[model samples]
Target: MKKKTTADIIENNKISDGIYSLRLKTELSNGILPGQFIGVYTENSSRILPRPISICEADEDKKELRVVYRVSGKGTGDIAAMKAGDKVHILGILGNGYDLECLKDKKNIVIMAGGIGIPPMLGLAKEIAKEFGGDNDKQISAVLGYRNSDTFLMKEFEKYCKVYVATDDGSLGYSGNVIDAMREHKLTPDIIFACGPLPMLRGVKSCAQVADIPAYISLEERMACGVGACLGCVCKTVKKDAHSNVNNARICTDGPVFLAAEVDI
Candidate 1:
């Protein structure tokens, strides 16, 4: 992890009323992998510490990272207030990214992402397409779900592979949740990558467990320090060792990325 000044804010536009995407200039974004996030300081004062926001998009060529966030709380509201030239501090390219090595030579890859969970999947899809010879032999499908069509990021995924959208309000391709869309699509995937609410992730885990397909999931939890020290985002895993029999691993450090079955979810 590294501390860096936010050199520029390219875009602070609203994706929706409560959700906004910020494209900021920062060299810390370079070499970032999928599933890694940045800890951004919402306020200049030390009163409010940095908040972890997932790295939604990164332009290595431009040395910038983009984060999409919802105005659900005060810190985020302040971040939403940021302008094109505002300076901010960030610690980033942190946490364990998805195991890209796992996708090597896979013939079929399927991604199930809901809500903001689709962020990493966007990166994953691009990696998969590029890794497997441009999505020709390796088929890629994204079962993207949102509250409504406007919230879906299918347009981003469409450039990489086929996309199926499922919205609860019946404003998209399929009426129902993402799992329903997955079932309806009847995808026979070699591997599944997913991120979403716990219930949704749990459902994905249970489904993958039964289907005997390997899956990787990105988890969301509150954090104090974006690094390991805080012990704030502890996730219970079955793995146990002598010193730490509790298996209460730090999400900010140990993960943010875990095998589907390893996490309690």
Candidate 2:
């Protein structure tokens, strides 16, 4: 159920080079889950297509949704130029988010994320803390990957999970990738939730498969409609999708979040 709504911008600030964190006051926050995304329309009439951004944080009580994105093109550039009082049209609470119920019985939970993927995990971690209570500190942990020491949302995550870092240039924590960080720290999880670039997801898939741990991943893709109307954001799946009767699943509708076992990516 996607509805087009106008939202007021609370704040739009730079998180780092090329990355911006945006928070909007919207009514569409009721059923939002960890991995869902929204289609944000640009003020420029020339750019009819909206930018599909992952929901970094969804505050149902406050009716606020936070989205962190990298300004890669003209569309996002236009969005970055928006200010506090600006209004934007967005279609949202879209995409199937992470399912946390199934992981409840698991003793240990680990969240793995990289780069912009780190934002959503913050919300997920907070929910995980709420779901598990005081035991969260011991049972949950996060393994985050970054290009360098410049990182955003580190303190926020520390409030919910034990944090570990991995940087490419050895500037922060581990001198390798996230998988390397996990390996070095010997941080094992009964279940894993992850989001990042395709390569990082592949590495997580390999690790999950080898260790026989249940894992879920949030995927990123380019979309035209930002809804299911176009077949633009389809991903390869292991099983046939009942609706389309094919091996492809729409990332916008079917998921941005999916079980690592079900999806090929």
Candidate 3:
């Protein structure tokens, strides 16, 4: 269930040039899962709608929810200006998160994320590490992509899984896209999970299909209402719904996470 509440900003740190990590103290963190998001209200009263930002980390014991976001517009710009001790209205722990249960039987799992899509994968990696334990045979490989060497969360991700990185410029890891890094490393995972731009997701889907491996993808979309009411964030689906008889799905509610083959992308 989603709740409308005011959350106190405990930490607001800049991660890169235009990126920031905002941590909030709230009771809503209890049930938040990897791949879920929070809708943050902007300070600008003119912009009534809240911006949907993906949850980067959730600490249930600490009652803290962290989100990493870029300043792309007025709403996010307002968010970027917020300081510690500030209070903001948020609605969340929303959306259906990644399906971790399905990956349990698979020994080798790959997590591929691009740009800002990299944050949520951290929580997923942590959960997987905790669930499988040190003696388990499961191996997690995380392939992350960035525009340049100025990146965040690399160290955090490294603590949980085997991390590989790719940058458009040769300043960092492999001097190409994540696909190139995966190829160069010869990574062969039994299942794949990805969250990135459309091109990256499409590439991952294609790769999974060729490899005959199951895959899940988290999508990014512009949303008006974070819930399903507004119908602003719908995507084309591969099949018609049994009830609606339409080949459309809501990105905000029906997913932000879906089987790679289920959506048109």
Candidate 4:
């Protein structure tokens, strides 16, 4: 919950057209958790305020953090223009992130992600692999999908766990979506965690339901106040009771991570 302009960009460049990864040297971001995000301002007084980007990887020793983003609009286009030594304003380790505690001790863990949805999964998988030691026989599997092979971040993820990949254009691992790939493998994981576009999540939820396995989904929404005060990121859930104090929970506060069935994303 701190606003710090105390660092310089170490490196920033195109990982692909409209996709870039930046490394920043910042002490304050060392303890960032997976699925948490940073709100960054491209200009000192830009009219659009700050844009929220997912925290991809963190190295406490070097006090380095990485954020991989897509240039979908003006704000992101500006982010793509940043380079080494640039000074930027960042407020973060913001929002509620995924709970690693819930994942501990599970015999089988499966992680599924799509597109830019892949970043947080990378953080999560890295932690899991570190905890269990990088063993090929480990009961961990990661399912990653992209629009095409050109946008894939495969090598970064394969180092830590068993991986399955899907692409819409048939340029990579499987010719269909991730859900299709999952069906092909018929995997029955003890715990499944996912983050992706809403439609993809919906399909994942159904698959998890049919398998009767627990699933967690990290919701990605357009956030105004990364904190909950602005009431800009409310999400509907099935947990609501007629007498429940709050029917909708703020994604910035109550969760960006929620039980798959509870979230209406």
The number of the candidate with the highest TM-score is 3
The candidate with the higher lDDT, 1 or 4, is: 1
* Rank ordering of all candidates by lDDT, starting from the highest: 3, 2, 1, 4
User: Where does candidate 2 stray beyond 4 Å?
Assistant: 136-138
| Per-residue lDDT of 262 in model 1 | 83
lDDT for each residue of candidate 1 in 94-146, tens digit (9 for 90 to 100): 78878779877677888899887887778777766777745467788899988
Task: List the global CA lDDT of all models.
Answer: 0.81, 0.88, 0.90, 0.80
All candidates: TM-score: 0.93, 0.96, 0.97, 0.92
For model 3, the stretches where C-alpha displacement exceeds 4 angstroms are: none
- Cα deviation in Å at residue 183, candidate 1? 0.7
CA shift of 46, model 2, Å:
2.3
Worst 10 residues of 1 by lDDT: 240-249
Model 4 weakest 10-residue run by lDDT: 238-247
* RMSD to true structure for each model, in Å: 1.8, 1.3, 1.2, 2.4
Candidate 4 positional error at 40, Å:
1.3
The local distance difference test score of model 1 is 0.81
Candidate 4: tens digits of C-alpha lDDT, residues 105-191: 667788999998998888888888887755444588888988888864678888888899888898888888888887687766878
lDDT per residue (tens digit) for residues 166-257 in model 2: 99889999998998899899988889999998899999998999999888999887888877888888898987867789999988888888
